[model samples]
Target: MPKLARTIRFDESDAQVFSRPAEAGEWAIPGGFEFSNWTEGDLSGKARQAFANGWLSLESFGRATLVAVAQVEEAELEPLARRLADHFVQLYGAPDAEAALPIAREEIAYMVELCADHSPNVLLAVSRELTEAGVRESFRAITPAEAEIDLVAIHGSAD
Candidate 1:
């Protein structure tokens, strides 16, 4: 597996209002891939609007970058991430990670939408790589508990 850094930026205003300060070693799942080495800040603002609804105003509130493992070569991750990010912007607008305190499970559905709308081709490519690595069957056989552990390890949360 190759360790890939996926970079995602949100308007600093959105970051301030919506996102938590990423812990030093936190993982960010901006789209489908997991990113570590997260760097977040209240940087600056630029106008960003949803392609679909256009109701949400988005801007560059903060920026984050994290490392993740990918089955593909490291070189491929960036382009793949770019495609996914574009897809996310098109499908559900940019991420607004803000949620009320005591965050409810259902409140973060936007994140799920982001992940799901990320490039299907990238997902298929990753799947092919996993199958080639001989872990596809094992992944398929994972118990719910094991799956939870895996998700937490990669995403830093089970929620």
Candidate 2:
């Protein structure tokens, strides 16, 4: 069977807002982060911390890592892509950040169930959107505390 494409996920953590301090000391817009991914074991703990600091988790369905942090809803496609990548990262955690990666079948199913309600097909249409957005890679890299996401183009359409 052909390898399954990276499943999409949804995370509120991706959205955030912060104000820059103009003077030496100033109060800014007290920013925050949101996201969704698949994290487990020790890494899950870290992800929890990341969440406290501002990060979310979810899981992916197959190979091909696709990451994204959505900010603007140019449309539904961008958010859809981020959701898929978040799913995998949340479930497996960052292999580079953590020593061991955890893969749980049941957990994966649960996550899919949770996010499947958001997108049934899992961003297949969004992939085309990313292509149109001029994003060569379907994946959008997202950081723990950092805000903002790389959006993909809609196939055959220019933004």
Q: What are the per-residue Cα lDDT tens digits for candidate 1 across 1-159?
A: 333222222223324433333322222233221111112221223211111001111122122322122233545444444544543455445563232211222222333333343321121111111223232211012223433443324333456
Q: Can you tell me which runs of candidate 1 are displaced by over 4 Å?
A: 1-70, 95-159
TM-score, structure 1 vs. true: 0.21
Q: Please write out the lDDT profile of model 2 over residues 40-122, one tens digit for every residue.
A: 33234433333233211222121111222122222533343445345446654544322222322333333333333332223
Residue 22 of candidate 2: its Cα lDDT? 21
TM-score, predicted candidate 2 vs. hidden true structure: 0.20
Query: For residue 106, what is the lDDT in candidate 2?
Result: 32
- Give the Cα error of residue 37 in candidate 2, in Å: 20
Each prediction's whole-model lDDT (CA):
0.27, 0.27
